[model samples]
Target: MNEDRLQFWSLYATRFAEGFGFITLVTLLPSYINTLDPTGTTILGMTISAGLIVGFYTSGFTLAQTVAIVPLAWAGDRFDKRTVLLAVLAIGIGVYALFPLVDSSASLIAVRALQGVAVTGAGLMTLSLVGEIAAGSTRANHIGKANAASYAASIIGSISAGSLFELFGFGPIFAVIVCLMFVAWLGVFRYLKPDETRIHGFPFSDLALNRRLLTLSSFRFQYAFSVTLVRTWIPIFAGVAAAEGGLAYGGLAVALTVVAEKFTNMCCQPFTGRLSDSYGRAMFVFAGGAAYGFVALLVPFAPTIGAALALPTEIVLVVPSALAGIVLPAWIPLEVIPTQVSMFGEVSPAFLPLVALSGLLGIADSFREPASMALFADEGTDDGGVASSFGIRELVWRPGSVIAPLLGGWLMYEVSMASVFYVGGLFALTGVGTFLVILVWSHGRRALVEW
Candidate 1:
């Protein structure tokens, strides 16, 4: 391969391996927690293992890591991003390998939480590195490409989790992941070098969380609602409902829902994003929200598994839905900073910290996407009401991302998975309503625009 291709692949492979190792376990972590006590959740806590052990434990990762994202990114700007990258990868390796050390549900949860903590370095560094490495004209494409690797990683990990669980069990599987993390760690340590300059001490307080930035972050709330709800609840919802719905391979059916969502997200991203840019964010957001609502509604009523698989066609579109919902709305306030580097550069030193603290909003809420989205829109809020099409993305969705599965687990406990679908559908519709409100808010009168 040529030099550029080699570099891209190197980064992509590292990301993919980390993602594959992490997502596979995360999606399966709740199930693993439950497996420790098949009899019921009493052995673990007041609620299911997912809620008490997994959910609570996992947020430590999200909170610390997400809060660190902008700072980490700022660090990358000033220091050699590669140094930050190597250091974080090393930490991630240590954390992931320890998973096999725990025996009980409690210990397992703790280990998972610590794993989240270790991963933030890897997570933020990786994203910032992508920003540093790719040129402006090609940056979005690179980010999108890297994002696609996340989808592939989730598939590889989740599918492997199923196969590995049936064969060597969770212990062996985690061990394997640890080993893989080490390899990625080595690759990063040896081959990676920081080509980017370090950012000077950037303000973390007022600038990062300024009115313009905060306003931009608020738009993410609706997008987050759509992303988190479906990813977390859809599978359990479908998996549980499938048995009653007379489906074959209930497990497969459940997996299919998730896989379909991701696949739709990846495949539809280019088309949907371009369409959104062409048509405007509002139109796509409305359509995407409506689509999610429609799919979510279908899960409860799935008459058969074969028919059930169809929901991902629209309902489960992960990327498209996010692009539709987030891209236009979230970009509004990003323009306040003008340039990507300046965006962080202009933020007060405390601004980054507060922005990071703002992430706690999502972390505390089971790491739901809405919190992050809301924060993004809010942070991006500005004076000119200018709009731009770029921002940092937090994509270390591993066992560290406990909130979704934990919520999924509780959702499984309280009501039928189908009910969760209904709720998810309701959220989608609500998002659509939010989009409409934005348009009305922007304009004095109500008028509809077509994509």
Candidate 2:
């Protein structure tokens, strides 16, 4: 391979490692909550609720990500992005290795916080490098491919994590992640070239003030809350107890629920990105965000949908003897060949509909993500601060990413679970409305098609 192709693939490997680690944790979160069983606690004589503690499980990670963004993004712009990426990957290896040590909620939060820093650094450097290397016209196409790599990793990670955790528990899962990170580190070290580009002073100030960026931020800011709340809750709704308003699925089943979205998003991004390259990116953003809100609103109605459609309550598969022997020799006895597997343990009528809705959510977001990313790359590349531009993008997402989990937890525990989806859907709808008015007012009607 040529040096450029090598570098691109290496960076895509980095994205894969990052996505694998992140999705593993996401896939296992319900298991963690079940294991930890968090309760009310007194801190400095003030009581904190269990619901808030549950919220902290996710918020702690995102809060750390919020904290790490400015410094990491600035370092990527001001110094060597390649070096920064390698360091982050090193940290990621350590973080994944530490997952097996999580004994309590507090410990998990601490580890997740460190993971946030690693994830932020990896994401910022890889994306900035991709944006900088690709030409403006094809930036979205390249970015779409990069993101597709991440989603592919997400699919594999969620499925493998769920399956492995079911078979061997958490230790082996992290061991696999650690080994993957090491391989990713080797790819970057051997194939990726050093980034010599440097920018002096802060570019965030300039990029933040860019009118186009500001308009995009208006939509992104609210959309962040919508995406974070809905995405994080999907696995939770699948795996948590039925009494908690979930379907109470097994690990593999829950993983499938999460995979539905990742799989569809992975499939659609590259094509949608190319279309956005030909058509208008802003139009894609508006359409995708609106579709996402509509699909999110339908999530809570999965049971009704399933019942009306007469969907099966459970799915059963009988494994062939040869396949069963190859797949489960270590976990199951050879005498148990031709095993019958219950994919969903006492699955609710909502399972199939929920998975379908999740896939629709992915289809919706695929249009929005690459298009929005291309816009940021366009602005940042013009301003000579691609990393800082993406930083501003991350910063715009911070408040929503940090706060939505807490809000979702409160809504999930205090109100109905459906209320969480309701509130999240409203945010997306309102956000698109605000984005449209601003886009038309600031850039005129033709802006959606032309820009």
Candidate 3:
């Protein structure tokens, strides 16, 4: 392979590893909650509720990500991006290796925070490098392909993590992740060249003031809350106990729900990105965000939809005779690994509907993501601060991503599970409204098409 192809693929491999680790945690989160059973804790003379502790599970990660962005982004721009990418990948290996040692909610939170830093740094560097290397005309197309690689990892990681966690618990799962991280690190070391681009001073200072970027941030800032809450909660909703306002499905079932979105997004992104390149990006952003909100609002109605459609409550899968022994030890009675496995523990009318909704969420985000990313790449490339631009993008998302989990947890425990989706959906709808108004007011009505 030529240098360019090798470099791109290496970067994509890094993205894959990052996504794999992130999604593994997400898919296994409900299991962690069940195992750890977080309760109220007294810290500094103040009592924190279990709900808040649950919120901290995710928020801790995003909080670290938020803190890491500025320094990482600046490092990528001011120094060698390839070095930055490699450093993070190394950190990732250690982070995944630590997961098997987590014995309490506090340990999980601390480990997740470290994971946040690694993931954020890897993401900023890879994206910034991709945007810098690709041609302006095909920037979104390339970015789409890169994101598709991540989503593809998410699909595999979620399914494998869920299945392995069910069969063998957490040890094998992190082992796989650590190995993947090592492979990605090797790919980068062997094939990817050092980044030569360097920009002096803070590009964020300039990009922050850019009119077009500000307009895009108007939408992204709010959309962050919507995506973060809905995406994180989909698996949580499927796997948590029914008493927790969930469907109480088994591991494989939960994986399927998470996979649905990743699969659809992976399939659609390249095509949607190409289309966004031809059609106006702004239009795609607006339409996609609106559609996502609409789908999110329907998540709470999954059970009703499934009941009305007369969907099957449980799906029974018969293990093939050849694989039965391999799947589980032969000495362990057939009762445990019975010929037929119940995918859903009990009657779960909401399973299919939730999966379908998650898929729709993927399709909607496919359009919005590539278009939004391409816009940021455009401004960053034009201004010679691609890394910082993406950094700003992350920073804009930080507030919502950091806080939405806490809100979702509170709603799940206090108000209702449905309330999380309601609030998340409203944020998207209102976000688009603000984005459109800003787009038209700042750039004029014709700018949406022309830009």
lDDT of 1 by residue, 1-451 (tens): 6655655665766677677766765556445544665333664455444334434444544555555555565555556656766776666667766766666766765666566555555655555455455554344455446556666776667666766665576677677677767777676665666464433445343344353233223334444544555555543343332332212222333344455545545544434433433443434445555665665565544444434343222222123443445556675654343221211112112222222222222222221222222222223222111011012434222222335545544565565555645665675567557656655565434333431
| Candidate 3 CA-lDDT value | 0.93
**Which tens-of-lDDT digit does each residue in 1-451 have in candidate 3?**
7888888899899889999999999999999999999999999999998888999999999999999999999999999999989999999999999999999999999999999999999999998888888898888898999999999999999999989998899999999999999999999999988989899999999999999999999999999999999998888888888898988888888999999999999999989988988886998899899999999999999999989999888788888766876777768775566677886566577888898899999999999998999999999999988999999999999999999999999999999988999999999999999999999999999877776
What lDDT would candidate 1 get against the real structure?
0.48
TM-score to true structure, per model: 0.66, 0.96, 0.95
Of candidate 2, the 10-residue stretch with the lowest lDDT total is: 336-345
lDDT of each: 0.48, 0.92, 0.93
Of the two candidates 1 and 3, the one with more favorable lDDT, higher being better, is 3
Tell me each candidate's RMSD, in Å, in order: 16.7, 2.8, 3.2
Q: What range of 10 consecutive residues in model 1 has the weakest lDDT sum?
A: 382-391
Q: Model 3, residue 291: what's the lDDT?
A: 96
